[model samples]
Target: MKPLTVIGFLGSTLDASKFGPSRWSKWRPSVALTMHEDLRVDRFVMLHGTPHARLAEYIAEDIASISPETTVDRRVLDLVDPWDFEEVYGKLLDFARAYPFDPDAEDYLIHITTGTHVAQICLFLLTEAHYLPGRLLQTQPAKRGEDGGAPGRWTSIDLDLSRYDSIATRFAAASAESTSFLKSGIDTKNAPFNRLIDEIEQVAVRSRAPVLLIGPTGAGKSQLARRIYELKKLKHQVQGPFVEVNCATLKGDGAMSALFGHKKGAFTGAAADRPGLLRTADTGMLFLDEIGELGLDEQAMILRAIEDKRFLPVGADKEVSSDFQLIAGTNRDLGRAVAEGRFRDDLYARLNLWTFALPGLAERREDIEPNLDYELDRFAEREGTRVTFNKEARERYLAFATSLDAIWAGNFRDLAASVTRMATFSPKGRIDSDCVASEIARLTRLWASDTKGDDDGLDPLLGDVALAALDPFDRVQLAHVVATCRRSRSLSEAGRALFAASRARRTSSNDADRLRKYLTRFGLEWGQVSG
Candidate 1:
């Protein structure tokens, strides 16, 4: 076996126990290094501040006497304040970088019992970063009656906590709590959605890759992106502002200038130089909502920006660079757009690396109550007054919200608006049964008008013969699917959106095939529905 090497700080006052009258006393950590049989310290690199140098020498002499085979190398490291994190961390990092590490010949360990908390933390950071490659050797005071009540006991702690079952369990719990935090306290009942959020949390923390959120409008893509940005900000991963833009709102030269900046005399309204959204997103995140609506020219520029981190501004000779994480949100079927020669295929391939499809409010009906409470809480905060639903009113509202007939086409946005209106119109800061009834009536009317006078566009699409042949339930489901497909850029996109729940449970995800089969049952084809 390779000899064990230890790198550590000499305990200034603590190491003096070696010279005490009692030779068998186990108070000092340095003297305890030779207590183990199988574990032997071949070489010790002792680091000490100016005042601790003498103590270090004395400890080194004692170590040499106790273990004649062990080599001792002592060095004086002056730290103004061992408690100051930055100063100690920088000095230790510099030392580690300069140290000759021979991994093939010796197994290294960091003795953490001799330093201040700050120094210990720095050592941990360096080891975890592999700047100093080694496990940690922490010396702890032995429990009473344990090993004859000895003072110092050496324990090795690996950086990967999976070696300890208890630590791993605690870490997993902490991770789950963090994932829940990212979801804004909405403990969703949908298992798949929860798992997706968990995966997203891991990805957001670990990578700087571009994330694509594909879901229908008001499905919380934009909100989730902002939450991710907040999480990263809390971790200090990103420092710049979160820049957001709706691509559908941009047009022509304005779109180019807004996204990629402009030269002083670039266009008609170019009064001064402008540093675009991409530049504004430096060291941060850029959220492009309705990304599918961007023109081909803009799409190509965005692709280049995402891939190379550089893009040419409108009418500029030089290309500007912005290092930013991209989070693109779209309700359109990008695959169909690619097939139809709208969205670039190369860009689709790049963005598809980490694509997550969000389910709408209708699909996650079980989570309606929690989301309702959340919306109410948000409403109270925004309006600067607390407004709550009475027990009966809340239950009634939840039931109505999650019902099959209530088509939440606008999803969370609509839900927020409903809560806002009800709270604003409520009496004495409480929503009673009458208030819920009125809100329900208002929503029903709004939805009825939205679907074009309650027929829901079914009559026109089905025709009399086809409409009469199918059962009412099948007709409703089929009509909804047809509407989704018509709005979708491709059949697969529509299928994924429509059968999101079914696809979650399916081991083999052939969404397009399943959708095609369902459409055929209704005497429908991709061409007919798309047209």
Candidate 2:
């Protein structure tokens, strides 16, 4: 076994005594610590200031006399004010850094019974941080009934709490709770989405930097942003109010006035001095939804505000400061926008530091079931009427919703609306098969109408005669394929998106060739469909 080493401060009052055997009658922590038969410390590192040098030497000699085999190493730690936390911690930290610690050969113990409270705390922190690689040794004086002169009891506390199952379990539970809170307690099951949320939870709690959420509309970007703010508030990271703004609604001069605040007489509508959304969110959070919709000028201003925390209002020479954490949400591709000269590259770079892309409902089909139940619970709370689907109806709705044919154009919004409609039209409180069937048909019609709006491109590509001969299923499928092709950069990308689920099962697959053959069957080519 490795030799035991004890490192502690010299207790000026507790360890002081005249040069005689009578000193043994009085219990000195340092002297009694060496007398313990079980704890055979091979080395005792005694620390003290310049004023306590003589006392440190006297205690070292006494400890040596008691246990001649033990080596007592005296260290001088000069401190101006022992009560000052910063000074004490800094001095100890420096000492710990300079000390040679050999954990492999020596079992180290930090004695906490011989220092100021500040020094004890600093020692605990250093040990916890592993600067002092050892366990804490807390010594208590003997009880009143016990022998007052005898060496007191000592307990060793390991800083690595994972060794203790109860402590480890509690920490894990707390972490899971934090992640669940960030997800708004939805219990999402999608593996990628769950991992993303876990990473987001860590970043949200630790960072005040700008975060950019990228996803399609109704993918819950705004809701997620609000949840992040709420989580931060729960952690006491922010004290100000959560200020949310939809940049899509702001236009030209109004956008500037609303965001950066305008001085009196700045514009025709600006009659009074207005503190903008940024100022209102001071020392808090600012969520800018549909951020990509903002104009180039506004984007530049926002970048300045984020970086410098100060910006000038309209018609004002002076600058106003607002230190707010920014959370930007956008469906549009800012990188593409930057390439097209629409968005400022600098602003995009700034916001892209901590960017997270949320998957749409279609991508996370497994999560839809939980979110469905959540939506129903929300409806019950809002309407003060509980509603549920029968077994068959619930299974039928889930089957259709999870199927590839169901196009969730509005993502979660569409799911919520469908649940609301079915709940409202259900006979009594329970949704029967008839209600679910009618809701499904209604959703199909709505999705079909949306597809038809984009079907104009189909007529021109397929021509009148070819389109007239095709069946309704063929027409709809071909129209969707052609539309996807037009939107994608290449045939391969379109095929990958079109066959995302099936492609995973194939060991050796050529999506481009498969797409080429499918297009050939319909007398269409990549150039014609993509063009």
Candidate 3:
């Protein structure tokens, strides 16, 4: 085994005594630490100020007399205020850095029984951070009725808490709780999404840097941002309120004024001094939802504010300051926007440090079941009435929801709305198969309408005359096929979905090939249709 080395401060009051044999009567932590028979401390590094030099020498000599094998190295660490955490910690850190720590050949222990409370705390922190690279040794005076003349009791605490199963379990449980909190208590099963939440939870707790959330509308970016803020607040990381801003709603001068505050009479509608969203979020969190919608000018100002925590209010000469943690949410492709000159590249780079892409509801089909229950619970809380689906209805809804045909265009918003409608229409608060069927039909029609209304299914690619030339039957069938292809990730996936019922009936089913030929019939390629 390696030689044991103990490092500690000499307690000026406790370690000090008369130079004769009377000093050995009382229990002094520093002196008692060396006299323990089981410890076998090979070296003792005693730290003290100039005033305690004589006392330190006396203790070291006395310790040497008790333990002839134990070598004492007295170090003078002069401190103006021993209780000042910064000065004491800095001095100890410097000593730790300068010291030759040979853990391979020397076992180290930091004696915490000596020094001020601040010094002890600094020692613990240093040891925990592995700067000291040792276990903590805490010595206590022996209680009454015990051998008062003998050395006091001592305990060694290993800084590696993972070695203790109970402590490790508690830490793991706390981490899991944090991740669950980030997910808003939803037992999300999607591996990628769960991993993303875990990463976000870590970043939310450990960092104050800007976090950029990229996802489609209603993919829970806003909700996740709020949850992050709440978690931070719970951890006492922030004291101020969460201030959320929909950047899409702010336009031109209004965007500038709203984000950076405004002086009274700064603009046409500015009748009073506005504190702005940034100011409102001071010492807390600022969630800029739809941040990509902000214009170049506003983006530039935001970048400055994020970097400096200072920005000029509208019509104000001097800049105001607001220190806030930023969580930006956007559906737009910021990388493309930067390349197209719509977004500032510098700002993109800054926010890109911790970018998380949240998968849409359709992408996280496995998580739909859990979120379904979550939405129902949320509905109950909102409506003050509990509603549940019949077992068959629940299974049927889950099947349909997880199927590719169910295009969750609006993501969770659509899911929540569908549930709310079903619950509101369900007789006696129990949704039956009929209710599920109606909701499925309603959602299908709604998604179909959105897809068709936005882009007249093959109208953009094929002009009016080409679409008009087709038969009504062919037009309807082709339109639906094209829509499915556009929504699908690949030709094979689209083919599997389009021919879900019939693919198994065929002996050698080539779904992608079948889809390719079908598209070719209308002189349409997969690339053209899918794009």
Candidate 4:
């Protein structure tokens, strides 16, 4: 079995012991820890200040005398003042970065018992942060009541918080709060989508690997990527600005020069040395939106850049390096693009490591109401105007927005535009039935124009065969009937809407009976039409 390596500060005062048969005078915590039979120490890395260098040597000699088989490596880490946490932590962190760690060859432990309080804290931080891939070992003086008392005891503690219920609960709650913050406080109803966001929130804070967002346009891929960057920045996980590029807008050599820069006089437009978006994203995040639109040559270069962190700029002789986290957003099916020889299959495989799919607004209609409020809030902040829908108007608009008629082809973007139009047109800070009606009409016209084939809306209700059998005049009339029936809650409501002019002419109104009879002519009932 591979032996365990122990690392810590040399306890100058406590480690220099007087020779004695009594355990209290003879045993030092660091020496006792090394002497533990089952907990074998193969390598000991002792950190010491200049003042304690001689004492550290004495401690090392004693440790060797007690545990003859272990190898000792001492490091001189001079802190101006060991009590100053900032200075102490910085020096220890630097040492940890420089130290060679081989986790596969040996298990490791941070010996926290021998250091000053500040040094102990710094060591714990390095270990917990994964700069030191090791558990912690603290040695304690032996129990005094035992006959002639024995040597000190050693204990190993793990930093995995899941092993402790109370800590795990706290961490889980904090993680949930962070996830909600990343989502802009919007509570999504779709369980899978919510879970996906939660996972993404964790990954954004924990890992710096490339993330690929796959979804249709306006599905919030770009927004989520920016949010991830913001979250990482908020946590101090990244120190640079978020740089975004839409690959779809980039074309040819201009795209290359824009992303990777060029040497002075390298091209006609290159008047001076230019640093590009990749370098701008150093120590931060790079969001490549519509990444599938990138040409094959750029894809190959990007693959090299992501894998090697080094790439030669356009017409540049030497390669520049930028260590940036990548977040790629795409509406296209890259797998299909790969099969068709459009995208590089190798690059696709690399970016596919961490992939997420964002659902479009049409798929999460239940979230529309909350997102409506969110968009209105954004508009108010941006335009310096506040607009709200009346209770009835809000209900009406939400019903229509959630309906099948509202195709929402542009997803969140479409919803945001709809809200913007209504909010802009609303007078006196309130949107009523009139405003809702106008916006609905405008949206309907927009959606209608965007759609292809039949403008005859009866195809959904009556199907093709039934519609073909009907006269052109009858088809038009039936479309109106079906639409009215859909909007009404009952037969009488449909009758009132469809026969408003005729009902006014009648002395005695049997509107419900008339509507029922009319619907029977088409072999349709209230349930069939309304549902």
TM-score of 1: 0.56
Models 1 onward score TM values of 0.56, 0.57, 0.60, 0.54
Lowest summed-lDDT stretch of 10 residues in model 1?
163-172
lDDT of 4 by residue, 1-531 (tens): 877889988887778766554534666776777766678888898888898887778778877877888888988988888898778877776676567776656788999997779889777766654557788888887777653233568788887421111211101011234337667767667677888998898888888889999998899998899889988999999999899999999998889888888899998979999899999899999999999999998999899999999888988989999999999999999999999999999999999889998877766778889789788767754554446676788999999997656767788999899988897776345578889999999888987776545464666666788877999888777766876676555788778877888889989898888988887887777787772
lDDT for position 157 in model 4: 85
lDDT of 2 by residue, 214-264 (tens): 999899999999989999999899999999999999997899889999899
Best candidate per lDDT, number? Answer: 3
After TM-score superposition, the amount by which residue 426's alpha carbon in candidate 1 deviates from its true location, in angstroms, is 1.5
For the record, the alpha-carbon RMSD of candidate 3 to the native fold, in angstroms, is: 17.5
- How much is the lDDT of residue 422 in candidate 4? 91
Q: Worst lDDT window (10 residues) for model 3? A: 165-174
- Cα RMSD for candidate 4? 21.0
Q: lDDT score of model 3?
A: 0.85
Tens-digit lDDT string for candidate 1 (121-238): 7787667544576888988767766773334577898774211112110000112343376788776887888998988899999989889999999999999999999999999999
Note the clash tally of each candidate.
0, 0, 0, 0
Highest-TM-score candidate: 3
lDDT agreement of model 2 with the native: 0.84
Model 4, CA-based lDDT: 0.79
In model 2, where do residues sit more than 4 Å from their true spots? 1-179, 455-477, 482-516, 519-531
CA-lDDT, candidates in order: 0.80, 0.84, 0.85, 0.79
lDDT per residue for candidate 3 within 218-241, as digits (tens), equals 999999999999999999999999
